[model samples]
Target: MIESRVLTQDVFEDLARHARRVEEAPWLEFVHGKLEVKARPDGNRGQIIAWLTRLCLQAYPDRWLHAYQGLRTETDGEGNARPDAVLAPIDTFVGQGEWASPDDVLMVVEVTSYDEDTDRRDRVEKPRAYAETGIPVYLLIDRDSCEVKVHSEPDGVRYEQVVTVPYGKTVTLPDPVGIELDTEPLKNWTR
Candidate 1:
């Protein structure tokens, strides 16, 4: 039998520091004081991220769009999460380090990968976590379902407004990020 131990913030930071030095370290996140390892995204996932990043950058030229950036969703402990992409104001991210506070974030985009855990994290847990910190937008692209979900209007640990659209359609983001994302290319992606 194996026993599990919860890691403190300091311990988690130390592990993260070491992990960064390794050339081939898997993506690591500290979720509720527990270390969660994620595999490297495959080619299809990479293409989706790239497309979204490009679109976001083009849509909001004055903002910064970061891919796989670690976010600090909690102030008390290690509640670090790495979303597929983060959109923030240009001035807010200056001199920021590896982890950014969700308070400064304008929006978070997560593209679901090929796994059950990824589905739950992107569809459920991530929205709750991001909303808890009052992030204005949470955009989820669910490849498995061929759908895109937009979650906003945070109240408590959930978003008050939830909109879902199937692939080949367009989803309009709310004000501050008022752009319609076309999902035609995303619909062509296959497992």
Candidate 2:
């Protein structure tokens, strides 16, 4: 097996920027100081993000839901995460360069893809990274598991509360993102 190389934050950022300029290039994320390529969203995944965007818009008209917003999850500048979606004040990311700070972000949303890395990237690494960044909420819509996991109450290292409910159920996002999600529509997008 060939050994994979780790990239520094600067090198990763440069590559990420270059990739953004090319059409149909897979999204790049730096996690744990390693390069991770995320496949472009399929139709089902796009629909899920659209559904969540509508809900967020209805809940907080003053807030904006940014799809695929890159965030600096580590204070030490170790890695960057591009959440499926992020809800924050309308102008929170304005004028902020690539990889904005997560301070103003109210919540980060991740819709798991059918890829093999979903478990490690979305389910495991993301929660820890977002929590460490002090993001108020981390919403994981697990298509493989057919469940929604709401993680909140970040105390620096990890989210203290993790509430999991299967699809077709009602799940309430906690403080900082007080929105009720009717996950029934999510079932339509699940694999």
Candidate 3:
């Protein structure tokens, strides 16, 4: 039996191999040199996501709405990361063709956990990737701070405008989906 000492090349090769071979591993992802297999979020987060999805779908019945949690997002040729919540067009998500590319993503909502580092990554890194791929809207719900930021006006490689929706405020979205999000339900979110 041979136990080989690991090398960077070996590790990179292993990661590359994993990316190459697709599996039914519940949407595993690699972010910042970490192989993260995400289980579903906890009770509070799940409740919020579910409520939001339900309301949004009800508001716009004709539109293609989805409530996908932690779908693999390929950032580069070999890197695959997953966002917390994604709302994409129904056509692409149905697997009618290839997996939904970043451009197909209509809106992305990230419910920040207690981890500031991960929140920072969601705030800083993901906007760049989404903007680069031309995803129109990126909405972030910060549970810790009790704030929401609606990112828009994609300029070059980043979102130029960030509309801040403070806690206990009814937030209004842009045209087409001109529905105002009531923050009343979220008041008891921390409990």
Best by lDDT: 2
Whole-model lDDT per candidate: 0.78, 0.87, 0.60
Which is the better candidate, 1 or 2, if ranked by TM-score? Answer: 2
Q: How far is candidate 3 from the true structure (C-alpha RMSD, Å)?
A: 6.0
| Residue-wise C-alpha lDDT for candidate 1, range 32-75, written one tens digit per residue | 54567766777887888888878878988888777788888743
lDDT of 2 by residue, 60-149 (tens): 899988998889986565778988899999999998887998889999999888888889989888898888889999999999999999
Query: Model 3, which residues run further than 4 Å from truth?
Result: 1-40, 69-79, 96-99, 175-177
lDDT of 3 at 56: 71
lDDT of candidate model 1 versus the reference: 0.78
Of the pair 2 and 3, which is ahead by TM-score?
Answer: 2
Q: How far does residue 143 in candidate 1 sit from its true spot (Å)? A: 0.9
